[model samples]
Target: MKKANTHLVLNCIIAEESITIEDVVKKTKLSRPTVVNIIKELTEKNIVFKSGFAEYTGGRLPTLLSLNANSYFAIGIDFEYPPIRMAISNLKGEVVLSQGITVDRSFSRNRIIEEMFEALERMIGESGIPMEQFIGIGIGLLGYLKANQGISLEILRIPEWKDVDFKKLVKERFGLPVYMQNDIHMMALAEKRLFLTDRADDFAYVGIRPGIRAGIGLAMHINGSFYGGVHGNAHLLGHMTIDINGEPCPCGSKGCLELMAGEPHVVARYKALLGDDPDAESIRGIRDIHARSLGGEAAASRILDEVGSYLGIGIANVVKLFGLTTVVIGGPDGELYYGLLRDHLKKNIFKNMSGELDIIVGRLEEEMYPLGSCFLVIDQYFKEPTLDL
Candidate 1:
């Protein structure tokens, strides 16, 4: 309980750049002596520093405290898909150094882990940050994960990753605590901390990764907590059947949204529409489609409209089910297609729903995954002690 109080007090101070003991006591509802003692301990550890004196009321001025942002560090990695990304972050959630390595199916699971370890080691060595400052490692991946047990039950795209004890492996190899979560869930966590801290707590994050084989993935924030249902696969919204008899998905479902609006499918639809055009051969991916749409190509625009309509249907179902007022679209493909899809998505959602909804396209860009993974570690500092990492 004392440790928990200390954490809470530290979080209060961190949240407010410069705060007094009275402020922390008020925010945490802890007794004044407890807040003072915790602040003293933190100051002794150099984790919290005396910034300056607060305003002088009638009596003496109280000392203001602030977090020492560089006192600790964490490492985060996103290994779900190609171009594995990793970063080292400070206590303030600022990325000090980040790097990426591309991989293909040819790289076995063991090989991927080995390469990841090497890259992380090289990064730490180059950054000149002391290893002792790092609290733990956080990893975000694509799959059904038993995050509490640090085991990945199944990864849709990587068949070889079945039943792997990722938490134990990482912890044993690095001699540090490890936290694991689904990629989309991690992104939602990041969104909560970085972008939506002042917004609604009940929102949904929908991500579309093009090459992962798995369709769209979703993570929900309910009542200020990330709700991963039993089996850690709740809200597989991508697999939702938008078309009853449209196309077969690997999940054995017909007319799933992933197959209908995912990047690869959208690209294929564009190519098919081009049908024997000499320029059709140049259309390789969604980016090309986006470019053509920007160039006012009628076929490309029509294909994007269709994709957006399908995505809107999926998002509408999510909004109706969760009664969510905000839906944030993210992921590599999502970033590229968001602008093209926003209006159609909004129109379909408004047509289906009764109230106003805030549809936001994520702006985290390339830092989305790694930074989210980093928060997987940073979040430990703010959660209640009884909560599992």
Candidate 2:
């Protein structure tokens, strides 16, 4: 309990820069002497320091305390299919340094691990931060993860990662504590901490990636906690069937929403609408589609409209099920198509009933993935059991 209270006090100081003992007491509801004692312990540990003094409106001006951002650091890695991203973050959740490398197909699992370790080693060396200063390494990956057990139950596109004990491997290799979670879940957590702190507690985050191989991903914030259901595979909103007898999915579902609205599908639709035109053949991905849309290509606009309508249907189901007032559409493709998709989503969402629903496009873009992974480590100080007096 004492340790938890100390952590609470530390978080309060971190959240509110240059806070006084009275501020901590009010925020934590701890007694004057207890807050003082905890602050002393934190000051001794060098986790926090007295910054200055507040205005003297009362008897004695209290010493202002601030978290020592350089006292500790954390490493966050987003291990995706092709490119792996890593960042070193300070206690304040600021990314001090970041690096990325693409995985070669010829590389074995051990080789990949070795390369990742080497990159981290180089980063830490470059930053000149001591190993002991790192609290832990947090990893975000695309898959159904047994997060508590640190196991990857199943990962899309990456066959070698299936059934791998990822957390154990990283912990053993780096000799640091490791936390692993679903990439989308980590993104939701990061979004909440970084952007949505003032927003509704119960909302949905839907991310649309570039390919159909991974399809779309979903995460939820419920009652102030990120919800990962039994077996940690709660929000697979992509597989929600939009059409009962439409196209078949690898997951044995028919007419799944991802098949209709994912980036790959949208690109395919654009190509099909344009037929065998050489210009159509040159179009590669969603970015090209967006360019064509901006250039007023009728085919591009039509395809996007179709994709948006399908996406709206999918989002409507999510809203109806969760009774969510806010839904954040994220990922690269989602961000690109936000303007085209907004009207259609609102139309479909309101069809069910009349309520105030805010469907906003996510602002974080690609950075959310790595930042979310970083938050997994940074969030430890603010975890569980409230410091209610």
Per-residue lDDT tens digits of candidate 2, residues 1-389?
Answer: 89788877988897798899998999999999999999998899788998999988988877899999889888988887567788898888888998888778568777877888898888889998888899999988776778888898876565565788888988987788888877888777777777888998899998777743646788988888888886567888888898998989867899988888877777787788888788877787778887988899888878878888887878877888778889898777666667766777778765555358887777665654777877888786456566567
TM per candidate comes to: 0.91, 0.91
**Model 1 — TM-score against the truth?**
0.91
lDDT of each: 0.81, 0.81
**Candidate 1 — which residues are off by over 4 angstroms?**
211-215, 294-296, 333-336, 347-355, 387-389
RMSD of each: 2.7, 2.6
lDDT of 1 by residue, 45-73 (tens): 88999999999896878889999988888
